[model samples]
Target: MIKFANYKKLYLIPKAQGLGLSKKLMETALSFAFEHYEQCYLETMHELKAACILYEKFGFTLLNEPLPATKAGKFNEEIVPLEDVNGETITSDEINQTESTIEDLATLKTIFKEDGTVTAGNASALSDGGSALILMSESYAKEHGYTILATVGQHAEIGCDPLYMGYAPFYAVESLLNKTGKTIQDIDLVEMTEAFSAQSIPVKKNLNIPDEKFNIYGGAIALGHPLGSTGSRLVTTLAHALKQEDKQTGIATACIGGGLGIALMIEKGVGL
Candidate 1:
């Protein structure tokens, strides 16, 4: 289930005031809230009605209403191209991958729920592949002259109802943000496993991640989901993606079977 949080006030340090930091801070905080929380409450005095206008401009509404409704097709259309792009980069001979054309997906038959959008065209393919990571402590890396692309930041796991398994990433990411004292605005890129279009769409919407910053190289739906290697694949791709984009921070998350979700934060190494 989705959750909510409230921010009753926002204060700026004396030295940081009057330099237009409040707007930036408020935007960052609100964007994070909208992404990670189901609802957000902001309390301000009547004298601050002008401030309320700012909040409304950022998508705040009376009684914490939900965001506008979105159709599954909108997400499907957007996702298919990303998957095709990612598919082009795969060179492993062990795995057989195929591009998902929008025209094909539009005509494919649903295989999951009756009349549902879930279909063979948009689901992750069962495949064979292997992935591994060599992890070392920061001190050890420095001592050994290792080239660090990124450092692990925070990790979180959460449990949810099995019926909504795909949404597990939302909760897991929320927990990671809270633990690290970070916000979605702080994340420069995200690599979420696209087990299915139906699952990935909701998670992306709830997280409020931008198209340019999420799964830029496509995802499991197109690249094929080698279940045992998916996690390592995500981590490996995320590290390369961050460096390629010249970004400093990223998160990789996925929903697991049996009502569980997982997320890990990564930050680029200093001076690299």
Candidate 2:
């Protein structure tokens, strides 16, 4: 019998928005979850529409009312990842992870996957939320006892085919590279929103970014994307990731609806 699962606090930095790393991470996590458990549940504020959407995308449904048994309790056994529904884990060493198909959607129609490249599973959820940071001069930060995590070196925005909105990040990154006089090889981490895996996948290929160099933690697809706030979210995620991984530089980029893209280059600051 299938059981229930829960996903707790998940986030990313601003510089890494629009890259589908979140979904990738979620896939691995979910595969592991289903292998050991059954249903996976995530809780989020109603205002965080994108996250809620992501939950639904992953075969989760919203309850009209709160659970009657809300008391927390302990579990007897620890869960572990062993295999998926098919008795096979999606891993390169054993088996390839094929793109999710209509069969994956028990109820919802497959959106953007046919000719589009983005399926309901691979696309970002519509979200509502915000994130921010306090920016000040080095003198002020030092005087005020503020610890800087990263320094913004460059920013770029560009326009592209409106119909093919996913590719917008490509041009933005291209422009930022030109302006900063740095190539993609110089970047250590990237936060790209999984706005649509269809779009994000192409962006990764075009930029020639190795899978390991991008969204090592995950992207918006699984984490939930808050529209206006995602830019700041990526930056914050990147900052923390740099400190945790002891890396030097990273970039956060996103593709906006209506033919637009945004990218930011950041360098790691002092310890943390």
Candidate 3:
């Protein structure tokens, strides 16, 4: 679900977990997402510390807030510690001045608990998959009838103990509001990947976005994870839904492998 308007960076790396799959995906995706903006943004998990180190190379940093990704240890035991996921220690120093937050680690742990705060019910379903999308400017959208969802607002990445890898959405959403002139109250809907139920519930409660504003259609838990594609998938899904329903301002984000996350906000077209 990774959608980059006016950029062509949708590359699929089969069985990519072994050979820096996350890095390659972002390298291409960023090239695409940023082609239209002055800057680029993304997120990840502490569980995938290796990927975290690499993204810093491209100016990807932690923001004052975190992106969203719920936990899934309750429904399944698929999740592991951030260190276990990377097989190496990733100190914050290595991440440098990258954007991130404090709640990230607590949220990371919640993603892998059998009865943790974050559970599979709300988090995204883990599986092997990839996705891509193309967003266009208003002028271009009008020319092509590209359905306008929410506008890409702000994004950030954060880290923590692998256990709570699900709380990133809090920061990611907060930053989006700060960047644009909006708040959770202004957001009409959201398409958060179902990494865990805890991830979404807490974020909704904290941000005051309301349950109705989140994943109306089936999320990753019901559909499928498709890893690399989840971020872009959320973006496109939100936009498509907003346009179809004639709403304004939708947000999307996904929990990444390396203790991080990615996010975007789209402003719906006026009175459709």
Provide TM-scores for the models.
0.63, 0.59, 0.50
- Ranking, lDDT, top scorer first: 1, 2, 3
- Per-residue CA lDDT of model 2 for 80-186, tens digit only, reads 23454455652211111233333454445555233322334555554434467767777788899898767877899998645545577889999999998899998
Most accurate candidate by TM-score? 1
Best-matching candidate per lDDT: 1
* Residue range with the least summed lDDT across 10 consecutive positions in model 2: 69-78
Instruction: Report the Cα lDDT for residue 268, model 1.
Output: 77
Per-residue alpha-carbon lDDT of candidate 1 for residues 148-262, written as tens digits (9 for 90 to 100): 8779877999997555556789899999999989889888999987766545655676689886778866667655676467788888878877776689999999887655799
Regions of model 2 farther than 4 Å from truth: 1-108, 111-118, 270-272
**lDDT (Cα) of model 1:** 0.59
Arranged by TM-score with the best first, the candidates are 1, 2, 3
C-alpha lDDT values of all predictions = 0.59, 0.57, 0.48
Error of 3 at 33 (Å): 28
Best of the two (2, 3) by lDDT: 2
